[model samples]
Target chain A: MIRDITIGQYLPGNSVLHRLDARMKAVLTFFFIIVIFLCKNFWSLGLMIAFTLLFTAISKVPLRMMLKSLKPIFVILIFTAVLNIFYTDGGRELFGFWKLSVTDKGLYTAGFMVIRIICLITGSSLLTYTTTPTLLTDAIERLLSPLKVFKIQVNTLAMMMTLALRFIPTLIEETDRIMNAQKARGADLESGGFIKRAKALIPILIPLFVSAFRRAYELAFAMECRCYRGGEGRTRMKQMKLKARDLGAAFLVAALFCGVFFLNYRFKALI
Target chain B: MNENIIEFNNVSFAYDSEIVNAPAVVKNVTLSIKRGSFVAVLGHNGSGKSTLAKLCNAILVPQTGKVTVNGMDTADNGLTFDIRRTVGMVFQNPDNQIVATVVEDDVAFGPENLGVEPKEIRRRVDEALKSVGMYDYRLFEPHKLSGGQKQRVAIAGITAMQTECIVLDEPTAMLDPRGRLEVMETVKRLNRELGITVVFITHFMNEATQADRVLVMDDGGIILDGTPKEVFSHKEIIIDAGLDLPAAAEFSDMLISDGFNLPDGILTAEECIEAIYAEAKKRGVC
Candidate 1:
């Protein structure tokens, strides 16, 4: 059951999007998100959708897997759609109720929001689906290096992030082992109230925490044994260099941003 | 210059030296590891074997005496980095040692920390991985690897640092039999082919038999230290140290008591087999 998580999952591929620089992909994803929000009408939203789908297709990640990334956010999507349908007002009223009314504007707004959200999720997940988490964190470190002027420990933060990403699967496995051990000892974690179930997790949590601390202690020694003395004077094996493909990707995203802005201005605004 | 890669001069350490009269974990242990020799340390739990391994690389500085790695004193604060770089260490738990998600990146971590150029780090990473027979799994996630494979990768991490000596603190303890064999073979190759000095701490008698020299620790002191054959020959001392002999040695010792003229110090199965075959021929028995 714990294995179902797809966050930070990378599908190995050699597509153009996959080969794009991680820093460029990250920047473009940020810009694409802003463009999605800047979208003022269905025409612009539709263009954003097309842009997202085109990149997804270029990434060569399976469509089903991309959709699977949305499964965890399904509840939020539905909640937003419902709230917009009932709360938003304007245009001709289509249905009426005691306190809430559905109008054409409300329906249009709900459709726009749902589509906008779908595009936002798919666009960002595309970056993760193509690039390994290591590259993404490396990109983050380099991108945030400028913030060092503010006395920020950007390198330490990035190292922490990398370590967190590296240990997620390991800790999950540890949790699974602890849970199974508790189960074997006749601990009732399955059949109980919410509070009771949470109480039952105490047995699992204690061991997990203990083992995690032990792991941390050993890991510190191991890192030191490897001559790690913080990020100062440290060089990376994989250097992030911007290639022609990165520029090409940037140009493509820029084109999408312009098209969205043009459509937002050229047509009548709809909300 | 001394031929020893590591020298311990009456080194003693305690986890709680702040307390009045805290018992030392390592008690005045004076030892030297030769530049290219393979030394295995055998002891039960809480016997200071791990402490000795830590002292080699300055992970734990000696409280009473001194430890020198490649002729540099570990007790000196400024030389700690250089000491660690000279004597790389692989801990018992493989999962805890890996710093990178991917195998190649984890192996590159040491060289990266030492500020080697990117191209050299890549070259060393590839060479280290290939030497450990893990080049095929360079792109693989470390969590997906078997215990032995992860341990080998940990060794490769140390190998990439190009350290002259590697101290493994019970590397095969968490592995299955096959995993143990794989790690042992990889370690053997690294020692024999690459000429890396190894200080392996393990309780497995069979593994100790393969080492060029073996040290038996008891209550934070070296009780026995000699060549594997010379060390295992003292059966009473070994049994009294709360350790067992290798299976071949035990069987051969029993056969000798039964009047089969087997030679002493049969530490491996092949040696026992050859001895028994020669005995049968001399006795005119098939």
Candidate 2:
């Protein structure tokens, strides 16, 4: 069960979207999210949804998997949908209850909120699905590198992130091994009360922490032995360049932004 | 002007000097490894063989005398990076030593740290991976590789740094027999083909037999030092160091004890077989 937590979630492919620069994907994803928020009417929201679907289609990740990725956020989606449905009373009532009414505006707002949330998740998931975690973090590091002028340790922060991501699978495997070892010793982790389960975790947690610390120390020694001196005068093996497709991707996002603005203006005039 | 790639001069170190008052993990040990020579250090668990390797790379600064790599003093803070770059290190645990998720990136780590140009790093990474025969696995995530493959990648990491020497602290201690053989083969190939100085610290008796010289440590000091033949000849000293003779050597000793005239320190299967054949011919038994 611990293995199901896919932190990187990258699916390797040879498509154009997968070939775009990670910074391009990351920037466009951020831009797309802000565009989602700017949608003020159904037409603009429809255009935003169209853009997201186009991205999802280009990514070629199975629709079912994309929806499955949203499972963790299902509760938030439902909660917001229900709140918007019951609250907001600015139009004709569709239903009535004790001091409660479902108006047309509330229904529209609820639909828009649900669509916006879904689009937001799918768009971001597309970015992660196409770009490996290392590349994604590298893009972030490069984007935030300007903070170095202010004496921020941006490189160290990025290194820590990359290391954290690199070790997640290893730690998960360790946790699974420790849990099984404890289980073999007849530790009752299942079929227990809440506090009992929490208490039962101590054996696993202690060993896990001990092993993690041991690994951290060994890793630090290894890093130091390789002449790691706090990000000074370091070069990278995989260099990221803004290729033609990346520029095209940026242009596509710009066009999407303009299309959303035009649709919002037209819809406001009609309303 | 010393021809020695690594020199240790009366060095000693302890983990916790203030509280425990225990003996140093590494004691007054003076040794020098010639350039392009394959040297193996053998000892039991607490014999400080690993500490000696760390001292060579300046990971553990000596408490008394100094360690010099390529004529730079390891104790000098300014030359720490230079020492590390001159003498690379591969630790026992392959998993902990790997710094990158991707195999190629991990291999590129050392060269990258050295501030090599990006183009040069790419070329060196490719060359190192190919040298270790892990070029095909350059794109694979490290967690997906086997123990042998990971160690090879770790070696590739050091190789990409273009270092003149590599110090492996029981690199095969945690590996399976097959993985051990794979790593040893890679180590030998690097030493032979690239003329890279190798300091292999291991407890495996058979592993020491392959080296040009073997140093046996007992209680943080060198107890035996010679060619494998010369060192394995002193069976009592090796045993006293809490190590066994190579299996072939033990077998040859068995034959000798049974009144056979086999020579001492027969280290390989073929040599043991030839010795038995020679004894049988001398007895006129075929």
Candidate 3:
């Protein structure tokens, strides 16, 4: 059951985005989201769509995967469009049925909102899809190092993230092993109602929790033996270094934001 | 004995149910293993060899009596970490003990956790990997490695910690023939070339032949302890414990039963061949 959920999991490829510093990608994504929120009207929305499409193409991520990520949000998207279209009573009232009144302005907002949301999901998924979670967390730590002035333990957080990522596959593999073991003992996990199914998970859950604790204890001991005291003077094999292209990426995103923000004020004010 | 690296005295451990005595999992076991020696402990599935290995480094403290390593009591909570470092453990399932995704990282994990300097860790990690001949696979993910390579990496992990002795519990249980051979060869190399005290727990009698001393356990207690030849000579004791003698040992015994006066205490294929040749020389049959 855990194996099929591959939404934010990275797909390895030789793409420019994949090669970019993790810190840069994270910062750019934040600014892009801001730009997305400020977008208004057809030209701005079209620009956002074109930019995201260009990102998707460059990431070399399969279109099928992006579509898969949008599957769970499909219901929310439909509801959002419907609510915005029918409930708004601004501009020209084009249709009226029962208590519902469709307006021209409402249509425009609804259309733009849907486009913005779709773009937002795709753009964010692109970040995770290109970079492995460990590198992503490392990038986050480097980016957040300034918070050390507040005495924040960035390395600790990064370590936690790395450990979590490292264990995801391990835990999934463990769960599968335990399920198979239980099934061998004639534990029927299938063909049960909600309560029975929930109860059946006990065998798997108890073992998983127990093993997780065991692993944690062993890891602690093992780490201590290796002289892992804490996040003090640790060096990494693959250092998270920024290149000229990283700065260029930030500048490019800044330009995109400026253009998007100006269009929002100018276009919306005239309208 | 150069030094008694491991000492167990009247140690008994039980799950502590209502039952009395209950044939303690490790019953009244008193034994001392010398440093820089390769010792193999053999038994069937329920013979408690694994329990003994765990007690060596205080993975599970004895319910009664004590286990001490190099004068440090395993029961000493303060020295527990030090004791664990002094004697590292490699379990049967390589998948269960690995903490890192990458091979070199997994090896470095031990020294890194021990709070060694980054440069020192890098040096030890490289040396440990080279010791096991796996330096080339430094960057590879552990899951991508073969069973033998994974086990080698696990050994490298302990080696990098600079543990003087390593307790390996059925380390080749999950491996194929080639993998099992690879692991056994690595264990022997670590014991002889590196002069690391090795306490190996295994079911395979052939693998146990490489050890300096062979200890057989049955019903949660040591049944026999001696040199491999002296230990394997007790065929009846081994068969009663539901474990077999090494094939070469068996072949030697078979020749003796067939009315050939082959000398006893044969422990390997080469030894059996040499024994047959000696008999042929006596009879001018060679």
Candidate that would win on TM-score: 2
Ranking by TM-score: 2, 1, 3
Q: For residue A127, give model 3's deviation from the true position in Å.
A: 1.4
In the range A1-271, model 3's lDDT, one tens digit per residue, is 5544432478989888898899899989998998888776677777788889988998999999999989989998999999888866668888788988888888887887788889999999999999877678778888988988899988788777766766776778789999999999999999789999999999999999999888777666545544455667555545567898888778878878877777776675312
- TM for candidate 3 is 0.82
Could you give candidate 2's per-residue lDDT for residues A1-271 as a string of tens digits?
Answer: 5544556788889889999999889989999999999988889888898888898899899998898889999999899988998887578888899988998888888888989999999999999899989989899999999999999999999999989988988899999999999999999999789999999999999999999999999999999989899888999878988998999999999999999999998877212
| Fnat for every candidate | 0.92, 0.84, 0.20
Ranked by lDDT from best down, the candidates are 1, 2, 3
List TM-scores for all candidates, in order: 0.95, 0.96, 0.82
The reply for model 1, stretches above 4 Å from the true place, is A1-7, A82-103
Top candidate, metric DockQ:
1
Q: Supply the TM-score of chain A against the true chain A for every candidate structure.
A: 0.91, 0.94, 0.92
Which digits, one per residue and each the tens of the lDDT, describe model 3 over residues B156-217?
Answer: 99999899999998989999999899889888898889899999999999999989999999
Can you tell me the DockQ of model 2?
0.72
Worst 10 residues of 1 chain A by lDDT: A1-10
Model 1 C-alpha lDDT per residue in residues A82-174, reported as the tens digit of each score: 999998967899989898899999999998999988998999899898988889999999999999899898888988988998889889989
TM-score, predicted candidate 1 vs. hidden true structure: 0.95
